[model samples]
Target: MHNDCAECPADSPDDKVFAVFWETQSNCQNLVGNPHTRFLTHIMWSFVEPGEDGTVPSEFQYWSQEHIKDCILQLRMYEICIHDVYTLKCDVVVVVAYVRFGFDGIDIDDETGNMKGTHQDWLTHHGPVVVNYLQALRDGLDAIQRPDEPRYLLTWDEFPSAWDPPDPTNEHYTGCISFHEDYDGWHRCYEPRISALVDMVNVMFYNIDSGDWVYELVLKDTLPVKAAAVIPKNKIVVGACSGQGCVSDQPIGQEVYNAGNGSAFYRGSNVR
Candidate 1:
């Protein structure tokens, strides 16, 4: 979702997303007097590092479960649903607390892709086992449905399509490393199959200058992956950033919207 930055150019009328990332270390007090508070639809809670044993270690220094509950209750005033996603590691056990804490969804973000062990391990071995983990997480979220409440979301912080190297001969030039031509392992992690399992593949764009570069990255790299039908265009959400890690050289939210053919723009900036 777009923020109320005057220096940042506005998004198109059709681009209707105003999401933000809320760091777990921050408290609800920070939301007070926030100008962009009125426009947010989603707020993803950041960095719940999980262990390989499928549990969030109590030793971790982020907010306690009760604190998260209080924060969620306070955030409801703005009508924004919180995606309490775990970062660094993936754990299915913590999915049970999703409804208990009034969470709207689960976002799995393991940048190293080493949830199972080793980089790219989960994606590479996402077969029936990984599928079952996703299914179990989905089922846990769905089992608590109340008809009146919005459906729970299951999204992944996916590798950006533009992350592929520039050289034509590079093996990873195709963007989706799981679907690379030379690969001979399991292919269930292939885009289309995994896309069906989650609500959205939230592309994580990091350290890139905003404006035309963001647009061109989506247009040239991201769209091509969709064109190949690896990942559905509709299921993709182009991530825009404007925080410490991101380089907001210029604002071009509308360019990202246009480049993605009017797909939702997920503002993944660390605006806390």
Candidate 2:
């Protein structure tokens, strides 16, 4: 029912955008061999969180000797992963950063009580931090030299699913996934505002432990429908979570039929 040729700005004139959300530790060999990766225009690394500073840390941040060794191992893994992506087919691989905001309705600050910046109040009072966080991400993307042709994206995981420091009596301790939790007011057209810096909003829309029926509803209706109305259909990349994280029995790929919001890939229950 939607137009596949809808004009959107992913830096690609064609709208046949197929994006995939991949877990960092997934088997790189399996990924490169999969038919899916051969056509992905975007590859997103999910569940990646930054330090308490809520910004991208420099390479030197891993200062300690042990930490440096660990960092080297991780870097080698990523290097291999990125190399494979380029050899197969991929426009860009974006790193998903988790916003440090604790909760939407109550608080999203650091769990250690060090920082304070509720998601709901970010746009009004603490907007600078949000901007900085996003800017840091953009800078990192801009510096990518492997793919040579890389695209940038701004996205975070489903943070509102549960809070870190759960309280026994706090009513905000529910496990429900809050839609637009930290972004209740952000469901508007952002073309002129940030389309230049961000290629698309990768919605990490899976692995919420939903049943088959619930998962289908969200895949086909709940999230995408609402997102399309607020943001341009072309600017939304549907992300599927996989591996021990998802319990839904739904199949791996769930492309929204008749929807022109580009293409989507499902990932759950398995890292690969």
Candidate 3:
């Protein structure tokens, strides 16, 4: 959604870096005038936990549940949804989401070339588990979406694709989002095959707290580059954190970048 930056720059007046602010620590008043508010193209109300053990994860959480009813009431008070989405502009911002969970350290069985006996049973079959999970979400959203209205959104944060593959020579079977030989040397979980269901994926590039200065990680072309290597740049957003122990140089990417403060998520300078 576009914001009214009346005197914004001519070349890139609407440059966006999607940011996440916790609902617990922030409110409408806290955000409206924040310095970083202007830079936000999308605001992900974050860390919304899903039902911890469901086959098809449910978006209900005891801690964050009240906000749904309360937010609808707030919308009623503001009378925002009376207008259709196309006409509403940014007057009413809404979102429905599923945070990516339990996606890590998948072992490809040597014989079968799979992660045996799990939802992500194999290298490539992992796609259907995610595709179906997301398609279910899409159907739910489509059911509620008003005619011609912009969808609120169904998005998630994905694990970084790779974690130092054992065989970088062939770059085979790197877990998480890495380039694997199984799917023709692309991210097993993040293929274009699921693009129809997923709207967006946030790649966390920082929190390399155990490593060197974040500047070394970002400006020098490391994690962020790895993230884009396997995932489509258009469907991805880069996230960063303020480096407490380390600093970084400039960054370069086609994806939207948003780095938050130490307390917030994502911290880094803008990359044009």
TM-score of each candidate structure, all chains considered together: 0.66, 0.45, 0.50
- Across 129-226, the per-residue lDDT of candidate 1 in tens digits comes to 55676778788888887876666777766545433433435653323344333343221223345667776666655434445665576557554554
Per-candidate Cα lDDT values, in order, are: 0.51, 0.35, 0.36
- Candidate 1: 10-residue stretch with minimal lDDT: 263-272
lDDT-better candidate, 1 vs 3:
1
For candidate 3, the per-residue lDDT at 270 reads 21
Which ranges of candidate 2 are over 4 A from the true structure? Answer: 1-13, 24-27, 33-36, 46-48, 54-128, 135-197, 210-225, 245-272
Per-residue lDDT tens digits of candidate 2, residues 1-272? 01122222334433544544444343455554444443444343323234444343332221332332343244344332221110001111223322111100100111111113333333233334434544655676456424644343343322212222223365653122122443342111122233334445444344444455645555566444544454455555554444543434435553343122234422111121
Number of clashing residue pairs in every model? Answer: 4, 13, 14
User: Using lDDT as the measure, which candidate wins?
Assistant: 1
Cα RMSD to the true fold for all candidates? 7.6, 12.0, 11.1
* 2 against 3, candidate with superior lDDT: 3
Q: Which candidate model has the greater TM-score, 1 or 2?
A: 1
